[model samples]
Target: MNNNNFLKPLLFVGPHIILFIVFILIPSVYGIYASFTNWNLIGDPVWVGLDNYKTILTDTDSTFYSQFFNGLKNTLLFVVFSVPLLIIIPLLIAVALEHKDLKFTSLFQTLLYIPGLISISAAALVWSLIFNKQLGVANNLFGSEAVWQTTQPYAWIIILIITIWAGIGGNMIIYRAGINGVSKDLYESAEIDGAGPVRKFFSITLPSIRFPLIYTMVMTTAGAFNVFAQPLMMTDGGPRQSTTVLMMYIRDLAFSHGESIAGLASAMAVLLGLVILVISAFQYYVMNRNAA
Candidate 1:
């Protein structure tokens, strides 16, 4: 019976195992292998051993490496600006909405979450129109002739604005869900102790959602690293490549500029993956240690 019980679980899990092996595991191993070869998608893959990696890491004049570094720098900048809005602003909104005396709570929740439902490509295109140099609504509204996408600081600023606008809603919903999961009795007890909203939030609300906070931080970090579509569509990594993000760099290396360096791109991918993994692991370790 015990053996049959185990077999039953395996039977249910067998399809998932097969799918994972066929899709994720196989592709990952193949990608690593392909990274070491000089495959241009048209000719046979020449086994170059570590040459591709060496070129990517050491070739200072190579556009691939230069673009990769530029993208990495921009991605770091995006994370620095985006993380606080993703975490703190949403938390504040969720806490405010959780108030029993708050008016139109459901309406406010729905309004906040609506932006998250918009398609990223469509949103990027729309923002591009708004940030257009000559005909943009923003230029008209501000009575300034500043070309948002053509100006260095304004290009990055536009990217940041769109990112925050599209992202905050989904994060707010997650935070609201976390806040909702907190036991009402805790709030009631706090109220009985004459704790005001600020005191209750600091002592009870924030502490209870520690798991969600960690989750939000990790996800926002990863998302910030992977920001590609907005910059790709809106800025084309322009304004002197100020908006060039890491994933876009990888994409350009792999397919764009009529010079497909698949192997070098794959090397970049592996390095990026390693960087993300290390950072995420460090974050987890720090958060866990603090909790302990």
Candidate 2:
């Protein structure tokens, strides 16, 4: 190949490579290094080797140990509650919208997808008003006397509501695109075989969109594990820190009052990343194996 041929491809992808290195790669490398050190975000990171990891992983009597485990437990709870709904609900909506009888399909799709574009912080403000104890629509419409944010299951309920509302749109759009791309010939053949809607869905539609299904599953699960803003903005990790996810603890440690404990924070972040990586890998493997 001529030099021009080689350089042209580079020209197309050079900016993206540069951006990834500067924004993602370098920072990730530095963060991992920071996790092994004693740093307060200043005075240079002191090389503490595995001290941070040891404290976080085995020092049960340490406050960081309790915070890490508690935050992790709550984070896992949020993931368990949210990921499945994010996948299944969107898939169902996408499949439902594919019906020939459905009118104004684009309008409905746009309405659903729009919420995903709204920032979580802004969306939380609107939801907060709706779930407000006294003046909110939820209480007035139902005529019930219950505090939504300061209660046990209620606090988690509001968080999940906003999360599902804001999240459903993106995954729905992905599923719709995946469904649309599947060949109509397959569906027609399934119909000729006397397959009903439910049967066609399980036998043909799902199999055809397996790639998108797996892609969304892994991505959604990873995102759910990193969940921070929804619980933070919605419930402020309240009702006694029951809603506090790992990210909240990590953030507080990195930017705490008096002195920052960024080394420990970085260690926590690294652990969270490892959890996400391992789970995402497992999801991909299982889905791919089943698909095969």
Candidate 3:
């Protein structure tokens, strides 16, 4: 191998490696270290060992424990409620657009893809107003006076709506790309054998895009676990904190009024990361096994 060839590859990757270490590796190490201490982000961080984790995981009488679990439960609820719709809706839209006879396919795809480009805060602001109790379009259109944000099911509904609206585009595009990559010969063979649309999709499109399916599933699940802006901006973790996802709890702990609980907050974030990691690994393993 030529010295020049090796140096060229390193030169191209040097910036990315530096960025990852500076922005990701160092911060992750510090965050993990901070989780072991009782830091308030001001005074010296005192070494508290596993005290923060103990309180969060086992101290039922402690407020931190309750908040952690509640937030986690809500976060899981959001994942369960939104991930399927996120995956399925986009896949269906992609498949629909792939049909040769679909009119103005580009236009429809463009319309769907645009939402994912909007900032979460901006999208939440629009959704919040739409679902507002008074002077909101939804209430006027439905002729109902229900407060969407501060209500039980309605609170969750609005958050999920915005999430789906913003999320559908990206996964749909991915699915469309995957679907298009499926060999035309396979579909042709299936059609000659009298395989209908559903059969073709299942036996051909899905299997051909197995890796993409796994990738989207893991990515979508991970993103769902980190949900913050949707519930925060839309419901403000309201309706009796029903919408208070785990990220909200973590954010509140580290930055809310009074002295910050950076230590505990860091621990919670670490725990959330562990959950996502484990779940994503399991998803990959299961999908890879099935593909085999």
lDDT minimum window of 10 residues, candidate 1: 38-47
> Taking the tens digit of each residue's C-alpha lDDT, what string does model 3 give over 1-292?
8799889989999989999999999989989988999999998889899999999999999999999999999999999999999999999999999997779999999999999999999998888888887878999999877888888899999999999999999899899999988889998998999999999989898899998899999999999999999998998899888899999989888999989999999999999999999999999999999888
Model 1, span 197-257: residue lDDT tens? 8899888888898888888888888777788887887788888888888888788767886
Q: What TM-score does each of the candidates earn?
A: 0.91, 0.94, 0.94
Once superposed on the true structure, which residue ranges of model 1 sit more than 4 Å away at CA?
A: 1-8, 42-44, 191-194, 257-259
Candidate no. 2 TM-score: 0.94
Model 2: per-residue Cα lDDT over 1-292, one tens digit each: 6799989999999999999999999999999999999999987999999998899889999989889999999999999999999999999999999987899999999999999999999999999999999899999999867899999899999999999999998889888999899999998988898999999899988999999899889989999998999988988999899999999999999997879999889999999999999999999999999999
What stretches of model 3 exceed 4 Å from their correct place? 1-12
lDDT of candidate model 1 versus the reference: 0.83
